[model samples]
Target: MIIGIDPGQSGGIAGIDGDASYAVPMPLIGKDIDGHKIAAQLKSLTPDVVIIEKVHAMPKQGVSSTFKFGMGFGIVIGVCEALGIPYRLVTPQAWKKAVLAGTTKDKDAAIAFVRRAYPSIDLTPGRKRVPHDGMADAVCLAEYGRQIMGNISEVS
Candidate 1:
């Protein structure tokens, strides 16, 4: 099984376990980054491979926000190490380029991509039907894992 995570406070995670596949919000502690709980969730999945989005400091970002993002990134990496789980890193550019090229692929594009890739998956809620970019991004991340590290399959 392959587990994919986008390591951001507003990000999402996706994984395949046994015969099920799920894409959901990244588990976190109330308002803080909680590496232990994240690790526990990953451990329970018993994934053979874990792939995380490789991100960096972008321009025009404030110091505090940048610091928090970096800290969260490190925490996720540290949790993987502590559990001795094998992981692979994929940059956002690399993955996005592989799936979408020569276009300004924004959140909406990501949602569309996931919908196209998994036409059967239900991505929206009942009332609002709001588009979920985080979930879409996580789905794409999992697909990137399949591209680079063959043999992982989506849930049926």
Candidate 2:
């Protein structure tokens, strides 16, 4: 299994193996992060290569939001380290170029791309009218790792 994570409140985590994949929002309830819950998911999924987004705070962002993002990132990394899972951190630019180049550079475009890539998956029609871009990105990130490992031949 390959697991990919986007470390933020609006981010998501995904696990994929062979023809199966699972994606969900980051396990954060308010300020307290449920690391145990995320750990459980990863333990169950048994990722051979865990991939996480290598993101940094932007200069225009507020201090509190940046700290929160960092905190969430720390929790995810902590669980990976504790579980002894082999992992890699991929920068957003690299992954986006590798996986999202064909898409139109928007959340809806991302949703459409993931929908086409994983036809059996229901990444479309998320809560309300908003598509789950985070989920799509997480899955795409996992696919990026899979491509790097030569596990899948989809990358161009």
Candidate 3:
């Protein structure tokens, strides 16, 4: 199985096993990342490899928010390491180019692309009941990983 993670409060984690796929919003305890919960989720998935979105602080973002984002990213990496799950970081541009192809590079476009690709999968598993960009991106990242690395033994 392969796992893809979008590390942020609004972000999500996705797992793809054969033709089956599952996704959920990043678990949080209050405003902080619930590392234990995330670790448990990852352990349950038993991913041979994890693909995390390579992200950086954006200009105009507040210092506090940037710090929190960095902390979230670190928590995800730490969890993977604790479980000995090999992970690769892929930039949004790179994965989008591979998975989204000719579509415009934007949240709406990503949601549209994933909706079309995994029509049976529920993109909106949260309370909002709306298509989620983070979940869509997670699926894209997983697809990218699958494309680049064929089988479980092929993960590097």
lDDT of 3 at 25: 81
Winner by lDDT: 3
Q: Lowest summed lDDT over 10 consecutive residues: which window, candidate 1?
A: 147-156
Task: Please give the TM-score that candidate 1 achieves against the real structure.
Answer: 0.83
Q: Residue by residue across 1-156, what tens digits does model 3's lDDT show? A: 888899988888888888888778888899998999999998888897899999999999999999999999999999999999999888898888888888787888888877887787688784777787788888888888888885544333
Residue runs of model 3 more than 4 Å from their true location after superposition: 151-156
Q: Flag the better candidate by TM-score, 2 or 3.
A: 3
TM per candidate comes to: 0.83, 0.88, 0.93
Where model 2 places Cα greater than 4 Å from the true spot, the runs are: 124-127, 151-156
Higher-ranked by TM-score: 1 or 3: 3
Candidate 1 lDDT for residue 114: 75
lDDT digits (tens) for residues 106-153 of candidate 2 = 666657767888876666434646667788888888878877876433
Better of 2 and 3 by lDDT: 3
Candidate 1 regions off by >4 Å?
A: 17-19, 101-104, 119-129, 151-156
Best by TM-score: 3
Reference-based lDDT, each prediction: 0.76, 0.79, 0.86
Cα displacement (Å) at residue 112, model 3:
1.3
Question: Which clashing pairs does model 3 show?
Answer: none
